[model samples]
Target chain A: MTSLILYTPSGVLAKGGPLKLAAKRLKKLGFDVAIDEAALAKHLRFGGEDDVRLEAIHRVARARPGIALATRGGYGLTRLLDRLDWSLLAASVEAGTRWVGYSDLTALQMGLLAHKKAPTWWGPHACDDFGRDELDEVTPDCFAEAMTGALEAVGFRTESGFDGLDTRGLMWGGNLAMLCSLLGTPHWPKVRGGVLMLEDVGEHPYRVERMLLQLHQAGVLASQKAILLGAFSDWKKSPLDRGYTLKTVVAHLRSLVNVPVLTGFPFGHVPTKVTVPFGVKGHLVVQGRDAFLGWDEDHAHHHPGHDGHGHDHDGHAHHDH
Target chain B: MTSLILYTPSGVLAKGGPLKLAAKRLKKLGFDVAIDEAALAKHLRFGGEDDVRLEAIHRVARARPGIALATRGGYGLTRLLDRLDWSLLAASVEAGTRWVGYSDLTALQMGLLAHKKAPTWWGPHACDDFGRDELDEVTPDCFAEAMTGALEAVGFRTESGFDGLDTRGLMWGGNLAMLCSLLGTPHWPKVRGGVLMLEDVGEHPYRVERMLLQLHQAGVLASQKAILLGAFSDWKKSPLDRGYTLKTVVAHLRSLVNVPVLTGFPFGHVPTKVTVPFGVKGHLVVQGRDAFLGWDEDHAHHHPGHDGHGHDHDGHAHHDH
Candidate 1:
């Protein structure tokens, strides 16, 4: 079985039940799940004090599990970006530890890409996606297949328009707000000609537009081959917003930038998120209304040593679609 | 008589009552006020379409009023930043137009500073601050005084710490979220050894902290002489936020950066706001619990040609102190 470590490096885990349940589910899925000792440590709204959370991160990196997952994301990783030992995290990646999680984890993943050119996964968190009262069937299955190296590609349907579009670039980005927070910082990855994937929750469309405009104004969007927009969910509509909706926002963005802006990617603060490899080279193909992002099976299967399991987990990526 | 132009460069007015009321109030305060032709134009949530707003800006610059006040700030300026004619605006500044407002106006103000090194006022909006049923006593008095070149310094009381402390640097920054949005963009003003002032409304402390950390990690805070924090108001408390408050946020930020973080500035999205000059050199002095930010009187009075009113506006900056 592939060893996996679950830790809380961002928001505090409200109760231990969810974490325990997540571990139980992962164990059943063939992961030798071990929770970090200080995973449940609390400090204000964070999982732990800054130093404690920092130490837990280094501890997980040192352990070098086949998969290192975050419990949940609220807002803590940006605080530790300055003090993080990127080399140690990169070393763990070299030793086959596939760091996984999205939202707040974008800070760590983007920082790793900027500092050490290491890849991580933009996937479901241990608690948020797997430990719910009603689990997302597709989430766990996709995560399991990806971890076991049998998942090489993920596909979704975007708005029709880019039907013959095909491009290849480094896959990058995560929670839109988290990615924007790293702008102008040392941790900001300067990935030119990359396909940027973006998603957010609870941010109004205007704010989403503002951040996208920031990226466009910074020349980040122009340098990319394509812009993949995932779910922008949970935001409330204001009375002030007469006809300005997310659709209008996308239209306005399309008018502003020449880069192809594709929407409806199965990711973000939603339950059924696909496990995509951040920092890997991905080939994107659009056929009719369907978009497929595929990576080399060899590269996706990072941990060759952990492939001794006889279980085959292919074709799980299409279940969510 | 000093000529002041009122224009809507950002959000829609919703109704024209406030703009009319604001103009009447300004006229009562002894100024010849004129509303822009497209001041009340509405397109979705913005005051007008992008081109119309952009034209209104250039039109104001061409008219060369003593004061150019934004009607309100909702979310339109960032879209116009790239298309703005900086030299025209700078020329208007040189010819004596005191551009003023906060919130979304931060984008235009910072862009002016970055492109042409011109100063603008971080002051009140025409509608939001002046058009209310019950007006704030200190706001109009401060604006009138500051416009006439009589108000040199504004003081406030803060937590006791750095007594007898004096530092001088360029004073910049407004609307924390707007400022952060410009980061990594060409419009980001590279102000070193500056006294950075920041404030916002409706953003959780965690988001505020993340933006501050971005500035800190970007080396912006380390390069600043001191930081002036105004009101971070309008955020609601969450059950998960145990003891996490704006107070704790300031404490955490102070622990990370070497710059002095002074609070209690009378600004932000509040009724009683002081009119302060943005992009101008300011002298900051601390005595016991009192802090005062003083700018050169000659510089504060940008419109020397309009000073023939024979009205003494001195001593008004202390009214709110």
Candidate 2:
């Protein structure tokens, strides 16, 4: 059977209920899910002390499971970036480990990209998605297909003015605030001509605009092949901001940068989010308002000569990039 | 009489009451204050649109007054940074115009330092300080003294364990968030072996820790002679954090970087604040928990031959460094 480890590399899990619920669900779905012993440890809003979280990450690398999924994402991994063993984590990926999660996981994923060029999944976490009152059909199916190498491309309807637009480059980005925090740091990925996607929660439109402008000033946004905007939810409007909204932010950015910023990217702090293989080479084609991100089936290789598990992989599967 | 221009380069003044209050107070103190016409102009939340604000900056440069005091600092200068004429502002400074303010003004001051090695003041804004119901004696005296070149030194008490510590470097930094926002951007000052002072309002201890760590990871903290921390006020505590306070953050950072972090800086959102000259060569001396920052007379210069405003310039003034 496909084996996965639920690791806590960020904020502490408040209760064990969600984790238990996720493990039961994943097991019922015919996967062996093991929770790291220290996953529930709490220390002042963090998963644990820095050393504890660092140990969890190193543990997953040593185990080299088929999937190493994060238990949750909050704010912790950025503290451990400088001390992480990037090569060991990359070696795990080379041995068929597919690291998965989003939100605060952006730091680790981007750090891996900057340090090792390793591929990671920008997808659902254990508790947030599967542990819900009723698990969403889309998220699980996407996660399962992605983990088993049966998924390739995901499509979404974007705004108009992008018809006949086609570009190909490596896919990277998550949580806008986290991505911008890496700017000018060693953890920042130097991905020129790459498809950059971003999403966030609980940040007002003005703050969002501020961050985007920082990237613009740093020449990061313009360096991208295409800008994919995901969900920016859970932000409250301020009384100070009259007539300014997320739409205004997008319009302002569009006026500044020379890149096509396509909205409606179905990812980030949401229930029905899609799994994205970050740092994987992909093709972006926009036909009118409809866009698809895909990769070549033969070129999208996970690992060579893997000791096959119960997770099935069809080499003939095609992805629309 | 000492002449000052109340310029609104960031947020709108929201009311003319504070401007009038500050102007009256300054005139009573033997100074002539002129309020910028665009100070109250509101374009959404900013004082004006990018071009309008940019024009205001250029106008201030051309009109080189004794002091260019920002009416208030909320958030707007970062937008017009890429388009700012740094040489013009530097020329204005060289002509004896002392640019003053803190918080969001960190961007403008740091940008000037990075681009032209120009000096600016890290101090209170017009509305926040002079417009208050009753002015604190220390604040106005400090401002008056700094502007008149009568104030050569400001002293404060710091924590123990730093007695007998003596170090000297260029004085830099203000408003932690604004400083971090400029990180990885061209505007961020690449100051080496500098005495960096920081303060902020409404940012929790964890957020403060994260920004500090970002600077640390970027090799910023270790390059400093010493880190002078000012007020971190008005942030609410999260129950999720078990006893993790700003003190905890400082202790954690001290363990990571090998730099003396002295607290109790009487600056920031508080009423009783001191004026600091950014980009000035100064000395830091610690004596049994008491510290003083001072500069020399002949070595201290403000733009060559400043036709000397009515503000007193004894030239024999000695600052406590």
Candidate 3:
């Protein structure tokens, strides 16, 4: 097994010793693991130097041609994304190095997708992803497939009795704030006909609705065949927000677009986070309360993890493997 | 002068005694003023039941006949944007009811633009834009011109040595978060070849950068001809992200696309905010230290608000006007 290069662009992992644990865990994965100590220190000290962060990325990508994943999300990658050598990074991606992370890691994911058109995942870090005992198999399978270049299947399945919507296009979107932050810049991708999956954590319903409004006004939400509602974890309401919730946000989305809008996706900042690859062409078909993910119109034999071909009120299509 | 109507969608204003102050100031515009008290109360009390909020908009739109603006930047319009009886609202707009405000007000702007294709401005609100003495002539002029169709003669002067950018399309965009809030929904308008202007207040530079990154990844950022940075007031950094600033964020944009990028344009949560009309085609050119705004490639003028651009090494083509 190759080594894992851990980076903390946001300074989250650096502060609480998440860095040390990350390094040790990756080491157990069977290869030499390294943490960008200087970069971590810089973030821990002064907090925002793209140079240190970039150096870390380059060094890891150069030395270990395997995987580069963020440990936790705080809030610094956006400040450095544009300045990073994206072209070289793109070349590097083509040269075969996988990048991973979620939450604030969305900074890197959005930029990579926009600037380099590189494929990435809307999944979890090693700590949250593999650290759990009851870890969902879907995420791990997807991760393994991507890392090992065995990701041939492109499908998802919904629960029984779930309302289904069918969509065919390249996948786009992840965290709401990350998506909102990229408006009026070169990093937000144009999702004319896309399987736009969205989720959030800790945001009030009104805030989520506002971000969704931005996507619609910017034309990013238009012309899509289906809308996928991913897992929204721990979203809160301010005392002043007057009881609005994500349920209202969902009803609002369904009210606006004729496209089949489905909710209950399990791929976001949750414990059972699924590794969803951005910038890949795929199809989503909703049959009653179930949804099936597939590469084409026929989603017969293949199952999309355990959550396929069922009536999933939560918007996830469960399929029997 | 006509008194302005104060419309509150979130209803938070119902508790504040100053609600009358907003009405009083707009009354100074030499016209009778009124507040949508019922709608304001309902929006704040019941939340997304925008029936009252929409009624407020319609009432002011019908009664005032011009510049139907929002009272504050909170979270209600996204829920109300679609349900607001936009076709009736469009008829009112055609009869000349101009709407304004940034932040959450972006929903109204986008709704008006997408449904009616009306030109809407990123103007100030009751507390900031309307009722303040620090208001400048340039702002009211831009807002006035766009509303009255006198945008041609209300010409903008470029900063000296600011040769300005070269291009054209409708200018669109608003609060970074508000725009992104509308993603995967129907409210976002298609922005193409237009100048994508953005600004925010009290957000981390990294956060701002992430929102921008998200837009780019969603494919929303590529279609714009130029990227305009509006006034970002008091947008500071966390101790965790001390070194990275908005400047670093701009540098990232500069390193990305060849499109003309100009900073320091006035919009967002600032005292001296300018009103930008979305859905209208226009051109934005930035040459060296100066920037120009025009309708198409045919005409080019200096950026209206600055005095001899080049405030810092940051390519901020702004003037005090």
Best by lDDT: 1
| Model 3 chain A worst lDDT window (10 residues) | A295-304
* TM-score (C-alpha) between model 2 and the true structure: 0.93
Q: Which lDDT values do the candidates have, in the order given?
A: 0.89, 0.84, 0.61
The TM-scores of all predictions, comma-separated, are 0.96, 0.93, 0.65
Per-residue lDDT tens digits for candidate 3, residues A246-296, read: 777777776766666667676677766555566667667666754554442
Candidate 2 residue lDDT tens string, B209-262: 888988998899999999999999999888777777899899989999999999
> Against the true structure, candidate 2 has what lDDT?
0.84
Off by over 4 Å in 2: A297-321, B297-321
Candidate 2 clash total?
11
RMSD of 3: 8.4
> Residues A1-321, candidate 2, lDDT per residue (tens digit)?
889999999988888899999999988877788989889988888999999999999999999998999999988887898999999999998887889999989999999999999888899999888887888777887777767766667778799999999999889999998898888789999898999999999888877888998889888889898999999999987766766789989999999999999999888898878877887887888888878887543333454333222111112233443
Q: DockQ of every model listed?
A: 0.88, 0.61, 0.23
Q: DockQ rank, highest first?
A: 1, 2, 3
Docking class of 1: high
Return whichever of 1 and 2 wins on TM-score.
1
